[model samples]
Target: MALKPKDIALRAASALVLAPAAVLAIWAGGFWFTGLIVLGGIMLALEWARMSEPQDWRAVGMAVAAGVIAPVIAAHIGQMSLAFVLLVFGAAIAGLVSNRRGGEGLDGAYGVLYLGWPCILLVWMRDLNADQGLYWTVLVFAVAWAADILAYLVGSAVGGPKLWPRFSPNKTWSGFIGGLLAGMIAGGVMAAWLDMGALTAFWGAVLGLLAALATMGGDLWESALKRRFGVKDAGNLIPGHGGLLDRVDGLMFAVIVVAIGRLIVLMIGGNA
Candidate 1:
């Protein structure tokens, strides 16, 4: 179904406000960026808990909150390895608490990883290369945002066969293609702007394509979660977007892809 003009306006307005703030945080790259990640992670945890176990939402939320916060703090302090370990430990704690309280232990555990890993990775990635970290972070955001915006616009205008009727009935093949192209173009442009070599630009485009695929996967996964919970939106935190989780779902996955890709390049003695 096409969004009403009012809905579109709301989305645009929200993006106008949020995008700049996010970009500014990314540029700041220290306490500001870490703070944003922490806040978003906490909100996501609460939302997940609310959806998964409304009756025991507080307990689950607190558990997930601890899980997300500890790792974020660790990552911010340059303890990447400790951050990963803390994330696992936090998830385990959350799971145990949920199981004892008669909630789904696996759901609670998954929530920590789902909402927390990206936060940790984002911080780690930002600190990976002091010189290029800003550019890389901005590139990830640009690709994800461009892909999402293009997908929505193209999908609504050129509605055709549904991409996945089960998970996301409203998504179309046209939208997916549009988003993919947008991601590639955005990544390439960012690389070129950074004055990287042509080969780097080509690799950037490839990364964008991978991120786009991951973005779609993330969106579909979130849709499946909502479907299982029988909710239309995660929460009404934003004017147009459903919640913090809804807004950052695709970006979260894209971050994971980009971070892993960077790590692989580093391990192989290649410049990322």
Candidate 2:
């Protein structure tokens, strides 16, 4: 379905306003912003959990555990080792506790990883470096947005072969390629503008492509969870954006991936 001109305008306008607001919030919002994200994670996690364990209170407990603890864990951004331990142990304990909920075992296991793990990564990425912290955050999301937005617009305009029929039937190979190119172009341009190192620029292109795919995986992953749960969307948070999960799906995957990459770079002493 085509996005009406008015819809496009509204989306752009909201994005224009909200994007800067979001940045500023992240910039100054500090740990509370991390807490706010954890709140969103809880909502999304609970929604996913309720799918297979509709009658379970343990699932709710797991969401609560995640909401409270994930932020505490996230607050240890510079302390990667401690944060990583918390995430792993938290997911494990949450998963074990959730098993009493019956068919929700797999659901709980995945939900914790889906909602909580990425949050850890996001915080870690935030504390990666001094000079380019905000720049990197903006680039990661910007590239992901380029991939998603372009794919939707171009795919709707020029439909083609399905990219993944089982998970996302409407996704097209052509659309995927278009999104990749658009993201690469955005990443490349941003890298040039930012005067990032050669390796950083290369990482931007490589990570941009990988993050796009991961972001798509996130969308399909959430869609699968929702389908099993017999829900339309995770929540009605955004007017046209479906829900918090729908909005942050890309971020959920991309952030962790960014975290891992940054961690590796740090382990080896990154250039900048």
Candidate 3:
């Protein structure tokens, strides 16, 4: 269904509060930003555990610990590789413990991997280099936000054929195109503003396009999960957005992709 007037108002109100707080935390990078990332991940873990296995303390604790610990360790020690190992170990531990709690290892492990690594990796991206880290981090946020906002607006306005009626009935092709275009533009503009050069700007636009696709994929994946589990919204944490996961589902996916891209760049000894 199209967004009602109340939905729009609530969304706007939530964004007004959240956007500024996020921007400020990001601008004050360090513990401030990492703290927020960890907190968000913990919240996601909690929601995931609750949604998947409500009242399962072992599963919930394991997920939360993994999500919170990964980013903190990565930020302090500057070891993305080690952080990754820890994340894997955490997932394994959660999985093992979950089985004892009458759940398949799959749910707990999946929840940790889903929420933990992304949180760590995004912070790692933001701390890559003192000068470039901020730009890249901001770029990810801007592109993701642009894509989400444009897609919703365009989809509501144009009312075209559904992109994937089974997964997300409200999504449309027009919205996808509009969001992709807007996200790419935002990426390119952010790159240029950061004086990243023309070549880098071009690649930024490409990254934005990929990120937009990832965003849609993430949203659809979450929706599919919700459908499979027979839940309406993740949780009513945000005013308009259903939960913390609902708000950053796209960013979680985009940052993982972006972090992987950054890792590849570093491995190749090319900074982009």
Per-residue accuracy of model 2 over 137-210 as CA lDDT, tens digit each = 66677777888788777776678788767666777777778787777776666666774444367676776777
Ranking by TM-score: 1, 3, 2
- List pairs with backbone clashes in candidate 2: none
Q: What is the lDDT of residue 13 in candidate 2?
A: 71
Clashing pairs for predicted structure model 1, backbone only: none
Could you tell me every candidate's TM-score relative to the true structure?
0.95, 0.82, 0.92
Mind giving the per-residue lDDT tens digits that candidate 1 earns over 107-212? 8999999998889988887876775677778878988988888898889888889999997899999999999999999887787777432327888899888898
Stretches > 4 Å off in candidate 3: 1-3, 55-62, 197-199, 264-272
Candidate 2, which segments miss by more than 4 Å at Cα?
1-18, 57-68, 71-77, 195-203, 264-271
TM-score of 2: 0.82
Q: Which segments of model 1 are wrong by more than 4 Å?
A: 195-199, 268-272
- Against the unseen true structure, what C-alpha lDDT does each candidate score? 0.87, 0.65, 0.78
- Residue 183, model 2, lDDT: 74
